[model samples]
Target chain A: MKKSNIKSKHIINHPLFLPLVCLLLVLIVNLIQTPSFFKITIQNGVLYGFIIDIINRSSGLIIMAVGMTLVVASSGGTDISVGAVSALAGAVCVAVLGTGESYRMPYIISLLLPLIAGMVCGAFNGFLVSYMRVQPMVATLILFTAGRGIAQLITGSFILYVKPVQFQYLGSFLPNVPIPTPCFVATFVILITWLTLKYTSLNMFIQSVGINPKASHLVGLNSKMITFFTYVFCSVCAAGAGLISVSRTASIDANNVGLNVELDAILAVAIGGNSLSGGKFSLFGSVIGAITIQALTTTLYAMHVSADQLPLYKAIVVIIIVALQSPEPKRWYYMIKSGISSGRSAREAN
Target chain B: MRIFKKTAAVILAIMMFMSLAGCGNNKAPVSNDSSDTGTDEKSKSIYVGFVQVGAESDWRMANTKSMQETFTEAKGYKFEMVDAQQKTDKQITAIRDFIQKDVDYIVLAPNTEAGWDTVLGEAKAAGIPVIIVDRMIQTNDNSLFTAWVGSNFKQEGYDAVTALENVLKSKGIPDTQEINIVTLQGTMGSSAQIGRTDGFAEKMAAHKNWKMLDKQSGDFTQEKGQEVMESFLKSYPDIDVVISENDNMSFGAVKAIKAAGKTCGPKGDITIVSFDAVHAAFEAMIAGDIDVDVECNPLHGPRVEKLIKALEAGESVDKIAYVDEDVFYAKDAASIIGKRAY
Candidate 1:
């Protein structure tokens, strides 16, 4: 068959198309509501207004969601501890680098160490889940509940105000531009991860475990090794997110940094048409989904909705998206298949 | 399969039984002592039931300590402090349990103003004086409690605004220029949120140039405060001022500002101002990270002692007792930070 012949089938088979459909629907509605919404303008040599700001601000979620998608797809597991992991990593980096009177740390070490710490924590989680045979949820739950406490205990609870000029430049934007550094770092990581998955046997093994761990183990695949690496990778991703987060803030307090980010990343992955039950993954879709969620919030804020009402709106949007993306009812789905099959048979007889 | 099923069922049942037993053991059994002699002639020590809002932050811990330290047996009161862990239903249950035990007076720092009138009314009908401390409740009836011993929250907000205005004036910033202010409000519908926000809004009205660019509830946590402040910085590029309802929240905002590569406090890109005279806030101010502090005066220990004394003497005290406070800056509180209890 020609490549064009397969292109039509690809649309129906692909999971990532669902979020694209939703995104289009939202864009169409916005276009109808506000005629000027689709327009963009440059101000003071920088892109301005609600949509741009939303995309820039949601870089952290986009990066984390990409990592979460892989972890979920590979091991049928979720990392609810990423937020705390990020905080702990940020705190560790700051604590090691900071002096009580003034903060001073070399630029490269401050940026690299937190991610390293986060990977170690993630590896710890992986070790328990893969080797110790603990449930992923249970293994990560300890970190989710107590990681921030540990972070605070390590950092002494006060916000570490670091003044290293070189380190401060990591999360800073270009002169007179609104483009955040996290956005660039997240985009680079996403590209690297995408390339790595495409070029490696790790991708196939990860998919195998996700499809059925029993089958992978029977085939002599190193299921535990794959599972362990998946979590470690996820932690590294979260560490990157945290580094950007703390850099964006120029200070780190273990108690409050990166709190509830797990929820945002999970929501982003879900909105990107990834399954909570696990199997398939989409990094690009998750990035768009993250921006979409942030955009919706920014739009709501611009519309003057009360702060209390924002959560309600977020819940409603999530519910609607999840419901629409959910697999069709079994009976209705079978009915449609049977109807199409019968029609095809009739055409063959003709 | 049947044997495995049975084993799982047995284990689950045993776990449930153990948890039930654990909960039963965890609760401290109330002891009733009716045998004490000689003290009965001179008004039995008033049993005080203090249902705290939990140690949510340093301020809450200070508030709890104040109640406990003041309402002691030596001060003619028996204090039973129940930690509610910041849960409303739990606090309500604790209050009901206190009422069942028939305490002389009930002190409550409610999680929120709603769902309180009924409980406070119940305490009132039981003839138990309910002292509202550190925070306020929503009630139309003033007779529900004897007195409210707390700082003038609205005044704290006014004081913050006053300090901000004076600093701006001293810096030679034009009073006519519209100053972009972002506020990290406490828990929504909380007494602190209401009083502090309203006070600042009212005072800033006189200075039409001072405009609130964004106001979001931080839920009184350092994390949410920082997160919201990050969004505020993104939303409003030139947010010149950050006003937090408490020290913890202001500290969170300071982090967000610094992360955004903006300066904090005097001569910085963004000025950090907040309520609560906690040691951390003082330290931040001394370090030039914070510009102003509106004193919330968390040392209500002496006031709690005075209230208990009046109750023991059978003397009717004022309906409300205001805690005296003053606004402080880095220079003003240089020597006093060490003396601060909380």
Candidate 2:
């Protein structure tokens, strides 16, 4: 019994525990509101249900949050330009595909072209933040404003539409496919990133640089190089997300494709128990965090919440969850618990 | 690193100069040669400066195309076109530029309803006729512009609801039968959202059996529309109709309905009513996925041109000129889908 208690305690104290609890709490609330929340049915050989929809819709944010975790861990600042960069990447890909002229370019070339454009954009941001020594937020703000404009310019200020069957599979389910393609894509990315970090010392180098850049530099770590790579990797992730989004709609709107998604990515990082100041991070935690947000949105919609009041409800719940994870509230809760236990022990002695 | 910095700065400088040169090139033909041409055909050709609100969507693109096609130099009009890129201040600057150029008329499509009073006062003082197109401005002074020409958005909403009612009636749903509806609104607080929501609700109130199951903003995007419709499917399984504020949202709703293993359209379980009779909406209608589409015509070019001619001829124009539009059912959509400009 004692051993079991200790194991349970250890699980509770784990870094991913809070986000899991928050997600569970939301799920339970939803189940209470509608008992069928967890029910999954297969339709036309594909999973058709609310839970599947949440997972599928969250794939873009999950990919974005993975890259964001690395950047936050390395540089101690957030990239506000991920949304715009995603727009630019999608625009580049769609422009090359050339609206109903998809036969002009091979599918692979269309896909690879956007990823390359995203790398260049990421490299520019990395150079500004690493070499020029500019603040990450300010450096990213340049692209945050101009990136969408650049995308508009690429498509000549028109929403580019493509009708490629191969590309549609990225966003939709194929014949007899039981899962959404984006879910598989997101999982593949997460697994690859996890395996790479496990086998290589890149994770250690990033954490050390994030913890103390000057000390890491003195110890022969190329901090600038690490920071630059992280930004580039983050941009690649954003590009992947952009491709999924454009595929979902089969069209690209420069103004609204990845609109305000950076905020959600940052929020996911924070909700995953990672400090905005940078240091130790969790990629899995961020994934769970992204899912939690999508679940919350799904729950709100199921509850028949008005669209205008959604932001207000979201803000209230987010504040409560974040405060529960903060240091001050935890400290207060521990103090109160110890005080009550000590008083009970004294009463027993008397 | 130093060499890289120098090269980057040079590249940026060159880019800046090129953009400035592009802007200068656009302005040169309008101003430098205008005086020469104005002297040659002073009375025959009337110079008109048109300020557009940018091509943000296909509708806006069609609107711009209409203006370009109708107001050409070959048609005896010297047209100076300026795209404001959805910024009110840019539109103001274009108006001021037009005033300085001494153009006979200025056609303004204001991006917002606020902040136009001051610049419009300047246009009025300069004695240049300004015809407001597409959107209205909030000016206490009535004479800030010559006329306002656009669609009555409220009427468009009423037409959409009427079309939906007709579909429901044909499906054997009596007026006394309780009808469940879910509304997918546009961006909240937008003029379209406010007008359409109010108009539909007002008409719906007259039907005692009509009930609004849920109303939420889809932000006029397909992705949001799909997500919202998915949730609505979970919340209200008995939804009889979906009133989408635009065609894009209806497209999304149709996808969601299909994904949920449910049929949509007048012949199906749910009837979808939408605004903005874009080509895609007509295609959906013909496919029997959407039941009704009320036209919110974006092509105001010919109407604005006609008004401009009237003003030049010293004829008085109406205070508010509304363009005529029609409501389309699935049967009628097949006939007109090819001729849709937007």
Candidate 3:
């Protein structure tokens, strides 16, 4: 016990400890299920491996999770519209720039425009919920349902194929490396967000407002402004994710772009130990959590579960994870143990 | 000078009144003839009450428009068009209203295959002939509807599988090869999903090696289809084929495959097959992004109009009118690519 406590103290203080532990656990599971899971190889100068693919895919979720964690922590509310917003932003870019030709624009403006679009969507959502006093879930849900439809409508509900060289560069790998630029961008955003929260009063205000919005307002804090700004931040993050997403596909289908991804982000945030009631947030933990989910899915696929049963398996796993991570962990464990012991006793009596 | 002014003013007033009276008479004759000739234009006067499933998709919108246009053009019948908005209760109410209106025939495109026996029984007791259009209603009592005018959904599924198998045969891909098929099913429990899945399974059973790895319902929405396909791709990394019940779902799968840096064809990427040869699907075939597509014709409006006219003429018609459609492979897609509306 003493030795474990000392190890915990050492590990808990380290910023990278949780992520390292998560990676180790995931690797161990993958190794048991598929022996070649850890075997990395260069295929045509691109890194190809189970782990690499998982990481590559988990980047989008991690970015969404970072923003979601902050919004949830700030008590503004959950944004179920990130996925839709991402789709909208991607559709906007493709619908505007896709002519099977190049679009002339300053590089910086091209990068910044999508982020602005996302902010505008977020502000619209914020206005409805904060100013109009609509339910956060209902207000955000309006976009969640209609955003993709509008995006599809704008693109004429068809797939827009663009072979533009500049747009493709966003998804390009680092020079002589297998790491995707989106992965790098996601990492950079995560670090910047974590550092800003760690070093400024913004984090404190978010937490305080989340804990008690009325109290925070009574203390002269601008709750509505904070709520509105947090949503804008969330939307901007989603927009960046969309930009990278389009780059990865090199094409855009508003119907298929960023569907149901908000759930993943929320799940990542929840799994990372953030409170659903809006309090202290965990940026680093959310990234690990997103990676964990991607790894779990990869493991399931490697096991060759049938396609029809995938939904059943997914539901079971999500239920189990949520049950395990329920706030009353002790109660859950006790209930399970009691059920097991009772069943055994009854069988023995029989 | 005063006499000239009076005469000019009287002439102007008479001209204005005559013009107004002529316009009013023109409307009177058109409106009267519209009612009289409207009933006489066909043959026997038959009233039709149509309970629509709502305009949820482009196909549905087209379906509704087709029926409405056809009915409006038909001279002898007064057809009531009801939009159920995909609601069962609304449809039931519509059916009851039709029964109350004592229409000669009732037409319905049921949202689901079940929950219609009671309403249909009432419709039967009322002796109001019912025509099932585009979709099927669930009931063992065939007496509920006078006839059904739609394509065979199960046959459509079978046709899609057949086309896919033909493509595979031409490619010389061995049947024994493990073909991991990810399916984007339509709305659960809907006739389309059941018929498509059953038909596909029946066809694939002959080839023991071809097995479905994963299947999920996208609720007939392109967005849900993509979401399901994204997770399916992540979970089943080695998916070999994708079969969508409809073109929209297949489109979503195509997006996911492309996003993962994979191809979407028998020769290059994920082998794909789908129903509903919407223009998008046809284009995908041309682009070599899709393998096969079976047609589920959305142009049932003209056929419905014909049936309505026949019923109004008091002429006995075939209880079930089957529409024929051709499946398109990439090889033949170029010829018919110009014909798709959706």
Candidate 4:
């Protein structure tokens, strides 16, 4: 349907339309509430304000959602272990770096090990889902529960600090740079993913496997392999996110590092109108959706929404965005449009 | 095949009966031994079985350490601890295990506020005095436990107000100065959040000139705390003071404040008051990032020790007791940073 040459007149009702509108609506609400919400000022050569925060804070989620989109598309199932994997990855990063106010190992090893740890975790899930024929949810549930426990074992049930100026650069800001470092990390990951999809046959293979695994296998596509690759890649992406978070805080707290982040990543995928059942996906939509989620959170803090009532207000906005994306509202819009057109023709004939 | 199945069932029944008899025999010897030792106080060690919620963070580790160090062979106490690993079912099982062993006392740091009545009742029936620690379990019967010893979150909050006053006096701000304050709270509806917020609010009511600009929950994580602080900075530009519920949040707030080209601490633009005087908070204070820290003490071991001694002497102790806490200024941080147990 997306490839079809449908008339441009229906662009208003396109799949991507409501999500962009939802994002705009949230930002617009922010603008109306606080006129200075969009204002950006330079502090110590870095851009400072709520807008910078929205971009910086959502970078981790955006990276995870991109990986999740492919994972969901390949296996036709969601990976709920991304959050826990990130926590374990963070623990590995800090454990290698040591809790002392210095790096215990070379900086490069600390970075690579977490990604490798994440790959192993993802491979475990991939093996279960693709080879053992287990459901993705059940496969990932093993890591979802045990990952934090493993992390705690590494950190000795403590929030160990890495406290060095250079360590904070990736998560916060680089020396004399105007933008947050996470923005670059996230973009680098997204760009690599986009290039892989565009230049390689991975995009087609994953989508084919997701749409129909047996048919894709019969058609000479390594469907199971594609599914496994997606899980591994997704876990690697989660590890990247873990690195970003660890750098941002310069510390590792297994219990709190990626707490409830899987729900956010899945929610971002849903908000982007990506089917959790798999087949088609939009990375851009998920990115925008992540930004929108961050925007809503910032808006609540800016509005000083009562602490207990914060979730209630956030739920209301989310429900409206989701309702707009649903079929019934668009069905009503098209029904009213055709009714008006017929009435106009009948009046002209009279 | 039917005859084989019957034989298997008979074997299983015998195994089950043997396990039940083994449990009965274990209980008998434990009770008899405890009774035998009660008459010879000088020769026997007082056994204390602690059912602890797992070490989820640095604070919990310190808490477990405090208890382990305080109750030892030198102190004539035999301490046995079961880490619940943040699960209530495990805690209940550990408590029951302690009961079967007939320990003189059972110390429980509950994971949740509910679902401990039956286990506590079992301990009560076994005549073991249960000392509740850290978080309180909700039970209607006050007689279920001997005494509850934990941190007074409200006192920490009240003490923060007093600490802030000292900070203000030193900064030369007048008592009647129109001070603007904001709070980065912990998770909403949590005991810490509710107690600290209420404690601070109750005391703030006495100061007419101090204005609370906003209060938001940061969920007690540095990342969320930073994001919320950024938002708070954007909304209220001329904020004077910040009350972060925990040290992690305070660090995040300090980062946000610094990124916004603002300063904090004793000589900075904003005076930051934080709770949970962790070692990191001491480091932060010494660095002039945080002005003062009010301790939510995790050293319940000494308090529990005192209670045990009182109960041993047949003296009635308070139904609820609060562990001692301290308020440390940045000036004190330099001298006291080395002594922090956590």
The global C-alpha lDDT for each of the candidates, from Candidate 1 onward, is 0.75, 0.85, 0.73, 0.86
Candidate maximizing DockQ: 2
lDDT string for model 2 (A1-350, tens) is: 76996797698779999999988988999888978878788865678778998999999999999999999999999988999989988898888887773556877887899998788778778878887889999988977887887787777777666766566678777656889999999999999999998899998999999999889999999998888889989989999999988887777878888899999999999999899888789898899889989999988887778888998999988998888789897688669877997998899999
Where in model 1 is the C-alpha error above 4 Å?
A1-15, A21-56, A102-139, A155-170, A173-179, A302-304, A323-350, B1-55, B64-132, B135-147, B158-182, B202-214, B218-243, B247-273, B277-291, B329-342
Which tens-of-lDDT digit does each residue in A1-350 have in candidate 3?
76996796676555445444555665686678778766666644556566676787778888888888887887646999999999888877776675555765545665677677687777777666655667778878977876776666556656666655557667646556666576788889988997888898888888888888889889988877777668778888898888877766666767667777898888887767667778677677788878877776666565555445656876776566555555476476568877997998899999
Q: Which candidate gets the maximum lDDT versus the true structure?
A: 4
TM-scores of the candidates are 0.73, 0.92, 0.75, 0.92
lDDT of 3 at A31: 76
Model 2 ranges with Cα > 4 A deviation: A1-9, A164-166, B1-40, B72-76, B169-178, B309-316
- 2 versus 4: better lDDT goes to: 4
Candidate 4 lDDT tens digits, A10-74: 67756677788899999898788888888998876789778898999999999999989998998
Higher-TM-score candidate of 1 and 2: 2
Candidate 1 lDDT over residue span B216-309, tens digit each = 8777766567667766765577888889898878877876676556788876867778888788788888878888899888777688668867
Query: In model 4, which runs have C-alpha deviations exceeding 4 angstroms?
Result: A1-10, B1-43
Error of 4 at B296 (Å): 1.1
- Number of clashing pairs, model 3? 8
Fnat measured on candidate 2:
0.45
Give residue A43's lDDT in candidate 3 (0 to 100).
Answer: 48
- Model 4 residue A12 CA deviation (Å) reads 2.3
